[model samples]
Target: MLKHFNAKSLFGMSFLVIFVLLSSGCDIIPGRHMRDQAKFEPLEASSLFGNERASQNLPENTVPRGEWYDIESNEALYTGMQDGEAVENIPIAVDRDVILRGQERFNIYCSPCHGRVGDGQGMIVQRGMKQPNSFHSEQVRSQPDGYYFNVMTNGFGVMYSYASRVNPEDRWAIVAYIRALQFSQNAPLDVLTEEDLEQIESVVE
Candidate 1:
């Protein structure tokens, strides 16, 4: 004995309930479309950017945009070439600190192949790999400082370039350390007198 029931009201309530249930499951609406899209495309290229090409009609010898030459003279534009003239003719001094830093860096980066003594007898060489010439050799000793720097920067023979790995100052420091190694190996025994031996003994103590 219900008081009353309206047929139209009951029908409207059922429709509202169906609408709420369908809207609540919104994630299912795009399920088949997403799966189809993934099936069509399995991979995509990265959108990263790289260096731009030089502009057309530029002179062949002209430096590229955003780049600067170490020497302004056209004669010194090539690799390993430096202008003969220096604004100040002072020779850069090689200090102990710089040599120590160079030695540290060389041990980390070069010891694997060049050895701690620069004798081309590193671990790799012990394993039967090709050994580089000793830095103490006459040919290497006669080479100019710039020559070593250039070789390290651009590489020679089987060696790859280290321009990206080491900076200019560090390269110069390594050159100094190499000189030190050569000097120690070739030092005259006569130069070490009794006083020098006593000094060494005291330092050891």
Candidate 2:
């Protein structure tokens, strides 16, 4: 049997059904069905925003904004010199206090690769890692203070720069300790006489 229906009631029911369908597709409502969609893609130019070519357009050697040298002053930052000129002719004096500090810092920072004694037989080497040359090596001994400084600043071969890890003064201190280690290893026998050895034995007793 067909029941008589009001036109207004039919129109209202149709509106309600359409609203329900739209509401069900919305992601905001829990358990609503939504088609899996990819995120909106960025414009083509946006991908190149940080590329090197963009950086090249900027001024040359201009220190980036908010970045600065860690040194105390501009003079301390870099001594302007090319290759051979970098080596200081003045003797590099050993500061006992600096050497002691360097020894402590070296034990913490360098001992893993370069041993506490600077012999390069660190634990890493004991575990089969590549061995670094000893500080006592002739090649190393021949290196000037500036050479050590440069190596610490720039690094060599597989070793990375220690400039970031250690400060200039501290780097110099490490050089002093390295010299001390070298001196101990290559000291003349005459420096340790029989009387000196007897005095040492007396102290042990």
Candidate 3:
């Protein structure tokens, strides 16, 4: 049988439980070592290191995985510029497979803001987010492939840099994919070969 407690008795029991929880705070929970760690903040003093510093440089030639060891080796590839200008060409070879890879990467990273077809009409844009410029625009099509790489690396107005999410090689692949989109949408009919025209004519028919 469930017995109902008097109001005074229940009030005392609730106050006791609240007191216990308040006193323990979060320490009563288990497996919070990372959050409860004793790590020091930046510039904090730590006698654990030889220099008694919180931060120390990695040993010589200690190349961290998924990081550029030396930007000097290829400044164009890393910084997306040559002589402080966007290069007219990609540093790496732009093969069919590479462009396909770029297409995949672009869909993952750029499509959220730029759309699948580079029209800047992605889902987020429909949801009241500021729309970006279409890649098919004359201004964008005239820009060099390195310009796209530079934008992805450094970010343009209202867009954040994807450098942390996308590596340099994939950034070029995305540029190639963007160029492919521009050509597919804005290529002149005069430039189409006889065979290419026939394929399009048959599809339309």
Compose the digit string of candidate 1's lDDT tens values, residues 1-205.
Answer: 2445478777898999889877776555666543455322223332332423222245579766533445444322223346643112113457889889889878877778889999999998899878999988998877776777777778989888887787656766777788788888886768888997798789999
**What's the residue-level lDDT of 10 in candidate 1?**
76
Best by TM-score: 3
lDDT of 3: 0.89
Which 10-residue window in model 3 sums to the lowest lDDT? 25-34
Report every candidate's CA lDDT.
0.70, 0.71, 0.89
Kindly list the per-residue Cα lDDT of model 2 for residues 50-102, writing each as its tens digit. 66233335568867653245443433233212444555521334567888987
Estimate the TM-score for candidate 1: 0.55
State, as a TM-score between 0 and 1, how close model 2 is to the true structure: 0.55
Q: What's the TM-score of every candidate structure?
A: 0.55, 0.55, 0.74
Residue 1 CA displacement from its true place in model 2, Å: 35
Pick out the ten consecutive residues of candidate 2 with the lowest summed lDDT: 72-81
lDDT (tens digit, per residue) of candidate 3 on 1-205: 1366778778999999999987887777686545867678888989988999988888899757856547888889988898899999988999999999999999999898789999999988989789998999888889987899999998999899999999999999999899899989988999999999999999999
Higher-ranked by TM-score: 2 or 3: 3
